[model samples]
Target: MSRRLITEVAGVIEAPVERVWPEIVRTVPRTELGEHVLAYQGGWWYRGEWSVTPVPGGTRLVHRVYDVAGQGWAVALANRLFIGFRERTRRSFAEGLVHLGNRLGCATRLT
Candidate 1:
């Protein structure tokens, strides 16, 4: 059996959640984040369930790493070799949001 790692990052976007959602969405895509994100090959991140939604706190990005047959090894490797993946992914997404927000019109700066 393999366990998936799930986490959330909340940030205020000068624009509404809907406005910010699309920019945020792109970073998770392989093309946008392929350089910075780890554990990815080709144009996919990992075999998982994902969603973005609006909530009282802010826009919520949810990602789940799953194990189904062949993916069992990936889950195990992620656990053993990349235990810090959750934090890394969180930071990557956060930084990406800042950049996207800037490009999309918001001038928020992570630096």
Candidate 2:
């Protein structure tokens, strides 16, 4: 039996998806790469995905974290014990967007 817990954060970068893709690949290496998508798996329970899409002004970058655990109860318990996990995830994603914006010399806003 497997269960998934997902968390997501999105930001818009003042650049095209083409420009943002390379930076995402550079920052997050050794992942399963696809058109505007990067997938990473860690340990046996965690999967992280980064994706970009063309928006009105620029590109929308979204990060999603998933806990896909066979032992769903254990994962749930662990998450309950981990204080501020969701907040930390959001903060980290925001910081990453800021860094990526700096690298691209563009502005980024969390959505």
lDDT digits (tens) for residues 27-111 of candidate 1: 5443333422222232233444444556554444444454333453466654685578668866876776577667767644221
Query: Model 2: per-residue lDDT, tens digit, 41-93?
Result: 77767778899999999999998888766663575677684578778989999
lDDT of 1 at 109: 29
TM-score computed on alpha carbons, candidate 2: 0.87
> Could you tell me every candidate's TM-score relative to the true structure?
0.49, 0.87
Model 2, residue 86: distance off in Å is 1.0
Residue 103 displacement in candidate 2 (angstroms): 0.7
Compute the lDDT for candidate 1: 0.50
Clashes of 1: 0
Candidate 2 residue pairs in clash (backbone atoms < 3 Å) = none
> Candidate 2: misplaced stretches above 4 Å?
1-3, 72-76
